[model samples]
Target: MSNIELNDKKIQILEVAEKLFSEKGFDGTSIRDISKMAKINIAMVSYYFGSKERLLEALILYKTSDLKLQIESLLHENLEPLDKVNKLVEIYINRINCNRGIYRILHFELTSKKREENLAAFAELKKGNLKSLETIIREGQSKGIFRTDVVIPLITPTILGTFFHFHMNKPFFQELLHLNTETLYNDYIKNSLTKHIQQTIKALLVYEN
Candidate 1:
């Protein structure tokens, strides 16, 4: 096939794969499903993306690149570090709310065997983002806007928790916390953001020097 033909097919496969993987999840969506939805042959899907797992990696890379660029652009110039931390969460949360499915897929794949081996690229990207957070937190501490005792290495999970739990758990959250389902979506986030961000900022900024 010609290069243009391959490019068109690859784009189509990516589009179909993203929606299917996001909606049906990695385990549920098969190559046949993607091929069928894409109106292409299985070989073509595999040929274009190499494998289902690679297709997903491509999807994640696409989403991450765009999002990271936006974040870097927003934070590139002058801004307070603590405020940047809050903006990080706010921007992330806003992005997730807009496209929860992609976040869900990324959350799901981060644990998969196929994804684990292919995760070195993602790890680098993640490390870069974490470094940005660390820098902001450190700066906030210096400014006395946050506590001085917070350790950057120790807080990655908490930041990830804020992102993951919101998408992964909702029914049990409502049942256990006895909160309404509909309202919990946004209201819970508002509450969590206010409390978590403030406490996280303080905990990471507490006196260490």
Candidate 2:
């Protein structure tokens, strides 16, 4: 379902579902749990979403709606291609950091056999984001800033995979970096990690010859 189609009641249910699903895995979270937490009746949720799985699908669409706007805005900016790419990295890092819980839910659900049907929900979103990256890369290539032989498919994963690896191993990283406080961890993500991902992508895109 599109974000425009969601009313307050539907958004409330999605918000509650995202929260519960993040705290508890998709399989662990039920429609009743969402309705109870949302202070609504089960029938209302069922009427809106039909089932727990559909609710999850709706939540994915709702949460990512802003991403399209962000990418589109960035694309419209007149910055140099490489600079735009760096800003894109910042956007992605900030997005994942801000919505870590929802991403975690997606990760868990993707692995579970019960959530097979929901795998495609992210495909269109990923495709859109990938198209944005391709736009920037094409601009860079056209201007001789980036190499023509760039492996387009590897670019998104390189950025996202690096961030995901760090997120999944936050405890190890916290110990390794000695980030004892929540503030320190967040600061590291916002500063150190964001720059690192930007630089990594920069290296991947910059022309070698």
Candidate 3:
């Protein structure tokens, strides 16, 4: 097969694995299950990812590759610290809303008592995002615009937990806010939810005394 076809087949397998993993959990999923779902032979799955563990690894890298790029690019932009924080909130909400399946799988794996070894891959992603936030916080602090006593560790989880909670319980939130249609709910997520997170983070970071 051509390189393009080869890449497409790999992605198709990854996408199928992501869906099955989200629904069945990682340990519950197998390479044979993925091949069956993807309508390809078991050997093809092995060829693409080698093993179940390797498949999950590839899925993590594939799904998060763009997000890593976005965060890196954001760090280089000439925006002010507060603007950078605000943009990061927008990015988080939008990405989480769009890729709930992968995030769900990651979350499950992160918290699973049976799967401690998988923590490294997820921790690396978390570390990178936290580092980006730390950079912005430090810049604001150095400029005397943000508080020196900022708790970076707590701040990172607060942003992620809040945004993830909102998206994970999206159906309940959609009903609570009376956003019946998907478009209405999406608008609230991108605009209202994004603004809320930005304000919360600003209150946490901005210097008062």
Candidate 4:
């Protein structure tokens, strides 16, 4: 179901679930915990989502639906391939910044025991996004703007891994860099980290032997 179609109560449950799941992990957080946190009955959550797994999937879909739409819009725009790629980096960084909890939930689930089952939907979403990036890269190659030998698979990892690595190491980096405030750390991600990722992707795509 679309994010718009979800009622207020369902959205509330999902939001609470996202936070709890991020903090306590998917298995650690229970339906009762979500109900208590959301100030709703456990029965209401099951009535809306049927199961914990389904609820998690719904939350993921809700978080990612907007990104998918934005990516589609960017793909249809009449911009240069490199420009589109840069815009994508900005969009991705913004999404991560705004929904750090959701990303944490995703990372936790992907490493947990039920990872394969829990992450199936997310894997599909990631696949589609990768395909979109591949399309852009291919388009650039056709235009002779991007290197013909550039590997899409390697490029995807370099971009996404960089973001993930920075996010996962926030505390360490903060201490190392003496980023005394959350505002400063977030600013670094939004400005410095984003520019670094964008430049890395562009350099990889356009580099010539």
**Candidate with the greatest lDDT versus the true structure:** 4
Kindly indicate the candidate among 1 and 2 with the higher lDDT. Answer: 2
Candidate 1: misplaced stretches above 4 Å?
1-11, 112-114, 144-148, 172-195, 206-209
State the lDDT of candidate 1 residue by residue for 1-209, as single tens digits: 11123367777887788788778778899999999998999987777777776777676676676667767775675887756776777766666666677777766665654566665656666777777777777677678776665667756566666667755787766777767767766776666754575566555555545
The predicted structure with the larger lDDT, 2 or 3, is: 2
- Ten-residue region with minimum lDDT total, candidate 2: 110-119
RMSD (CA, angstroms), candidate 4: 2.0
For candidate 3, write residues 1-209 as lDDT tens digits: 11123388888998999899988988788899999999989998897777787777777777776787798799999999999888888877777788888887776564755554754565677788888888888998899899998888887667678877887788899889998999998898888888888899999989666
CA RMSD, predictions in order: 4.4, 1.9, 3.2, 2.0
Candidate 4: regions farther than 4 A off: 1-4, 111-114
Number of the candidate with higher TM-score, 1 or 3: 3
Instruction: Return the TM-score for each candidate structure.
Output: 0.74, 0.92, 0.89, 0.91
How do the residues 1-209 of candidate 2 rate in per-residue lDDT, one tens digit apiece? 55438788888888888888888878788888889999999999998888777777777777876877898899999999999999988888888788887877775556556564564667778888889989999999999999988999898778878988998898999999999899999999999998999989888889666
Which candidate number would show the highest TM-score if scored against the true structure?
2
Considering only N, C-alpha and C atoms within 3 Å, which residue pairs clash in candidate 3? Answer: none
lDDT of each: 0.69, 0.84, 0.81, 0.85
Off by over 4 Å in 2: 111-121
**Candidate 3: worst-modelled 10 consecutive residues by lDDT:** 1-10
Of 1 and 2, the candidate ahead on TM-score is 2
